[model samples]
Target chain A: MDPDDLQAEPLSSGVPDLPPSDIGMSVEPATEAGAESDSSDTSSSSSMLEDDLLVLRRAWINERNSPELYTYEGAALENLMELVDFQLQSLDAQPASIQNDRVKYLVRSYLRTRLNKVEQHPGYVLREMKERLSQAELEYAEGFRSLQDAHVRKSFLDQFPAHLRRVDEETKDGLKMVPEPDMDRAVFCRVRTTVGQFQFDERYVSRQRRPAYLVQTTNMQCVVRTRSS
Target chain B: MLGDECFKLAKEAKDVTPDHIPAYNEELVRLVTQESRYLWRRVVELIQATESSSQQSSSGVFSPSQSTSKPDLSSQPFSNDPADVSRSMESENMQGQVALYVHTIERNKRCLMAYHRKRAEFLQSLLWAVHLAPTMVPQNVSQRLAPEEQNYAREYAKLNMKYRDSVEATLCPNDSLDWALNGEVPPRDLLIEVRVHRDCGEIVTQSGIVNLQAGTQHYLCRSDVEHLLTIGYLEHINPT
Candidate 1:
């Protein structure tokens, strides 16, 4: 449990050899029977293995789930290294008994492999997120450029419905209207109305009367005024 | 050693020098390139198969046996077989297939870049940790690194040293501590406001166990409720 002792030894010295058993397959019945026979003698060892497994599993899960970055400072890293060292020592002390339990051996190997991955998981995620962000930025830029190109090629009227175009045309027509004088009398004229030609008093047209016009053009009412002398 | 045997076997297989560990860069690159090519072919095949199947279905001449007799694409070993390559190339769907292949390659390249970037960052962090606390650097962390990663660590160390003084001046105390430790500063006694998202048991803290309920807000030190925040049971509210 001494940190100094843990730090003194090279980790390569503690690393166990590759398990002979294939991880995908279930443990052989012979190994299981052997494990059961020596169960009483190795109770403490088994419990320690179980404890180490739980801690490592939790650390692995946390490494996967946590938003926080992984580093060497955490209790999990220390605990994992310590457990690995312990497992290596046990394997050295009783090679036959340790190797006989196929399940334990598999767990140890799997744990070792996972520890490496777990340590690197945070960096992997950070890199992924950054690359994804850059990709998104590129997409955004492309989208913006396309939008600008579309906008530049067509006016708002051409891009939208005909109704908006008509409204724009009417507004331009309204703005173009001016009082025309012919010898002090105003001349008023109507543009593009469906109503029959009718005479209205100059005062009525000058007052901007609305109900007096009975013409509907493009679903909109239009009033015409001209000044005449 | 348990795991050391595996490395030894791999090293022997690769015929690496005794002093130099096998980085497996060439092997990984070859494998990835081959796999991508295989995947490209598989995708093209799948698309063509689906297209032909749909055409047959529409023509009211669907044959289940014919579709079933189609070669198992997954089992087909990837090779530079001229016949297979030429056959795929000659299809009228070549344009679409080529486009798909290009897109797949781009995505694969991006993934590889991300992986390398991750490794680089990990090495940089490791180097920084080693610089700050040599005793704490685990032997496994240092020994297992590839040659490229070792180079990355050396480069990062140089850059860090160059910017050390300037960076220290600009960084907040907490950030400075984090940089020095090469990790996040664990929750301590800093006061924080948190809103409960779900009902739970009272949190045991240095002061006492404080009752928590949904839709309730509490002002507590960070150390007392850091776990709750991590688990999404509570949310930290910024004072600003």
Candidate 2:
């Protein structure tokens, strides 16, 4: 995947489908069954399809690596959906309906990951980072939050006095009730481009060289993966 | 014991191997919930005292030490000197204890949430894996869920379908698209041979009805047998 794709690009159109060919897959022997497999198993898809697939892959990798949600790629997903639906209806392409499944699987994974993150850090997502979610995801977030609030209230919070019923406030420990993602945690990275130098913790001076970078993941949104390397 | 019960529940929630769902720990959950309520009540009592006292003074709500207002009503009934410096010190000490109790209560809440959320996640995944067919959930799995958890699973399954339909609404609507179907690796061949492992009775496939008595073999579309493959009713026959 191109490192440049990590930088913010103009909103292309639709959901950048995930390549969830891995995690949560019920079937076995699942390894990189993505674009390369798409090409090998069938005659080459049109260049446009290939391009859309690349965008989807880039989106998938970006969402997979980053702790924070990126903007949704709605246009690319819509286009791919039309194409996959077309292929499914085609007489010859019906056998390759597996292609549609792959696309659907990837898209489902992308959405699922976002949902996981939303559920994990609802306070942060609902307050500071809502712009990153698509319309459907936004609705899901609001609904899930209310669902949670209702659950918490019905289950135990109601047992407490009205003042203590509040769940999202800071605790007496001076820590937040809702945990935000720990950005300061160290994350391993591979350098796509060399940087001359950057200060670490205002104490140590370090230089990033090509092929590897082991920096704390805080605010380091550009998670470039050197898959070919 | 303040955190031990919740910590144990959290550890069990994370086990992903050898089938994810474990039988609900009803007794422990009840105990934890009771402890949480007890601690939370204490915290509220302390905080309420703090709030009432702080409202009379100009000092910040949390900064009981920096308080300049006279500590009149804060003195204990048994105290000889109601205005003594020790009176303010006592309130400060109470504030510190409140902080500790609040921490314990919140931590307890987090653990409880983690356990419940983990089970909820498992339920959602199982429902999706079976393509939203609740009846397809294995009997052992169904029996393990708590009654309340069972209700949550049913409601959540319905919500999940609506969520998927809304996701579909983002795309063209004419052709029915199933996002949860065949969440497996794309097979190189569209059709594969499979041997029945158990008596599945007569089952209809994409082709036609086939009796799935033990040892019966048939070639079927991978998608057609996908559910059976997951449920262990049939075994994939790899052609050598």
Candidate 3:
């Protein structure tokens, strides 16, 4: 069978063995009741849906711009893209009530599509961070190997410890070693932070005045004076 | 509220199904309803706040008596007075928006429930397939399953003969797997990639010992990792 033909068929049809009540009747009453009660609550809910739509729209735009979204299985991605397009088109053609419903579905599908991209896979930021860390490690290893060969190193620390450290470690060590290349000296220099004098005031100062205390004299002072006299 | 009732019913139905498949249908419905309700309340608050502010600003130009009556004006749902046509129009627009939102929520609830039901049915069918042909449980099939799903499939396969016979009689005869084992040739062993989600030491397979660690990916025969996949410790990855 053609792959396209399989896509056209409802994917849910794969499981048709469920009891009629299990699949159908059990759901209808609850939804109808929900719809009825929802009417009473609609005034309040309408504004909520608008906010949800706004967030969903923003998310959809972000997904479209995301580079990782393209990595999704071709058929699923195409289907979601088409669904979004259809929803947008219908928004104009339908009445406000219908349009509102369509917008919710659109937002939901958009979220699901975005979710499908990352559901099994790790988040884009995490994967990117891992890749960057690995690349940095590889670069550091390459730099260390090259430095070892140039300095006739034995232990890991001996290769570039003292004079080599003065030059920016990020640059080629060869340029720093040979003084003839004065033009490249600027590139080899490390950028250092300069400290300036800073003044700081005490955070807390006591505002309350000290209490006065009366001094009491004992008979010992008079007795001593009399004895001396 | 209605979503909650549906969720309760779905949960009840879950008890009738096999133990292995996690009953996520109820939880999904509950989450959707809860989220929708919170959003609805926020929207109402926003609309009310904006309306009250606009009334306050507009009332500043009017007399004290009219200003005093502003609370009443806000309380009234609709105004028949011709002078307040614009206010009435705005109210109608808001109502329409609300109606649209309610309809959308109801539709979403129904769709989610249907998907849940379908998923449960699919699991039942998969169990039936396992019961019919234990050996035909392909390596790729096991690898595709999560750990819990594998356990569930295996556990269901181990049900007593009476239960299996009853399931066989009731199960729909139109499943694609009904004819899976009719062919003459023996099933060939397929090489597949399995990614360990959790650490598992030296699994002895027909081929050799396969050591697994979290975040490690390995290529092995389908049979070696089928149990691991079903139990959710390992996930199947398409070979790059």
Best TM-score goes to which candidate? Answer: 2
Among these predictions, the greatest DockQ belongs to 2
Judged by lDDT against the true structure, how good is candidate 1? 0.39
Better of 1 and 2 by TM-score: 2
Off by more than 4 A, model 2: A1-45, A92-94, A172-174, A182-215, A222-229, B1-100, B172-178, B181-186, B199-211
Candidate 3: list runs displaced more than 4 Å: A1-229, B1-83, B132-139, B142-240
Q: For residues B172-213, what per-residue lDDT tens digits would candidate 3 score against the true structure? A: 121111121212111232567888999998898656677898
Best by lDDT: 2
Model 2 interface RMSD, one decimal: 4.1
**In candidate 1 chain B, where is summed lDDT lowest over 10 consecutive residues?**
B170-179
Between candidates 2 and 3, the one scoring higher on DockQ is 2
DockQ of each: 0.01, 0.24, 0.01
lDDT of each: 0.39, 0.64, 0.39
True contacts kept of 2: 0.30
Residue A183, candidate 1: C-alpha displacement in angstroms: 70
Query: Model 2 over residues A99-205: C-alpha lDDT tens digits?
Result: 55566666766677777788777778889878878888887778777766766566556665465577688755577767687667554454434544445567543
Over the stretch A137-228, how does candidate 3's per-residue lDDT look in tens digits? 22332333233232222211132213322222222223221112111111111111111221113322221222211111121122112211
Q: State the displacement of the C-alpha of residue B155, model 3, in Å, after optimal TM-score superposition.
A: 8.0
